[model samples]
Target: MAAKDDLGRVGEQRAAAYLSDRGYDVLDRNWRCPAGEVDIVASRAGLLCVVEVKTRTSLRFGHPFEALDDRKVRRLWHLAHAWIDAHPGRAVHSRVRLEAIGIIGPDPRSGMLEHLVDLR
Candidate 1:
């Protein structure tokens, strides 16, 4: 696998741990469907959250979340809907939240993770 892929995986694991520590119940990691891929799917305070994780060695270019442009947001929305459909029991009256997580450091395992929840 490419180094970026490893960073992404590690970033995701960090995101899960971060969320878990914050009282969110994680339902899925790397959730994918025809629409797109959701890095993390979790529930908190009766709301469903779709997280997009971005990991980089540094912010020299820009913040990791900056990569998730409008197109990505739309795709994430579709992916969230697909996830909802897959789990009927968890969809009713639930709200969709778009979150962005950024990890930056020399290595994925030791990177600093920053989570920005409810982007949309």
Candidate 2:
């Protein structure tokens, strides 16, 4: 696989670990539907969080969280609803949330990870 792909995988792993550490129960990874892809689907405080993982070498280009635009948010919202509806247990008292996971690098030496909750 390409180096960028490897970096993305590593970044996703890091994001998962980070979310788990924060008491979020990960229900799925790479959840998909007709709308689009949701990088991580987790629950915290009885709310379902749809996360978008954005990885980059640095902030030179732009903030990683900035990559999730309005269109992406709309897609994620649709997917989140679909996910909740698919799981009857969760649908009763569930709420949808949007988040962004930003990874700074795969450098290992100085890599940084950021999780922005409720982005949308």
Candidate 3:
């Protein structure tokens, strides 16, 4: 995989671990539809969470969370609905939310991860 792809995968993994440690039941990762992709699907406090993870090597360009623009947020909203439709058995009946997890730096152990919940 490309270096960027590796960074994203590791970042997502870290995000999942972080969420799991916080009592979030992670249901999926890289869930995709024609609309777009959701990096993590989790449930916590009776809410279905659609997570978008942004990973970066540094702030040279910008903070990773800064990448989530309005357009991407809209797409993620659609993708969250699509995920619910596709996984009827999972029964995600509670409220749905858009969340963002930003991972900065290369090392998963040392990187900064910021979880911004309820983006929408």
Q: Residue 120: error of model 3 in Å?
A: 2.3
User: What lDDT tens digits, residue by residue, belong to model 2 across residues 9-53?
Assistant: 777777888899999888888877776777888888878788888
> Quick one: ranking by lDDT, best first?
3, 1, 2
Candidate 3 lDDT for residue 12: 91
lDDT of each: 0.84, 0.80, 0.88
Can you list the residue pairs that collide in candidate 1?
none
- By the lDDT metric, which is better: model 1 or model 3? 3
The TM-score that candidate 2 achieves is 0.87
Residues 1-120, candidate 1: write the lDDT tens digits: 998787778778888898999998889888777766788888888788888888899989988988988988888888988998898986664477888888898786788778887785
Worst 10 residues of 3 by lDDT: 101-110
For candidate 1, the lDDT comes to: 0.84
What lDDT score is found at residue 89 in candidate 3? 89
What order do candidates take by TM-score, descending?
3, 1, 2
Compared with the true structure, the alpha-carbon lDDT of candidate 3 equals 0.88
lDDT of 3 by residue, 24-77 (tens): 999999987877778999999989999999988889999887888898888888
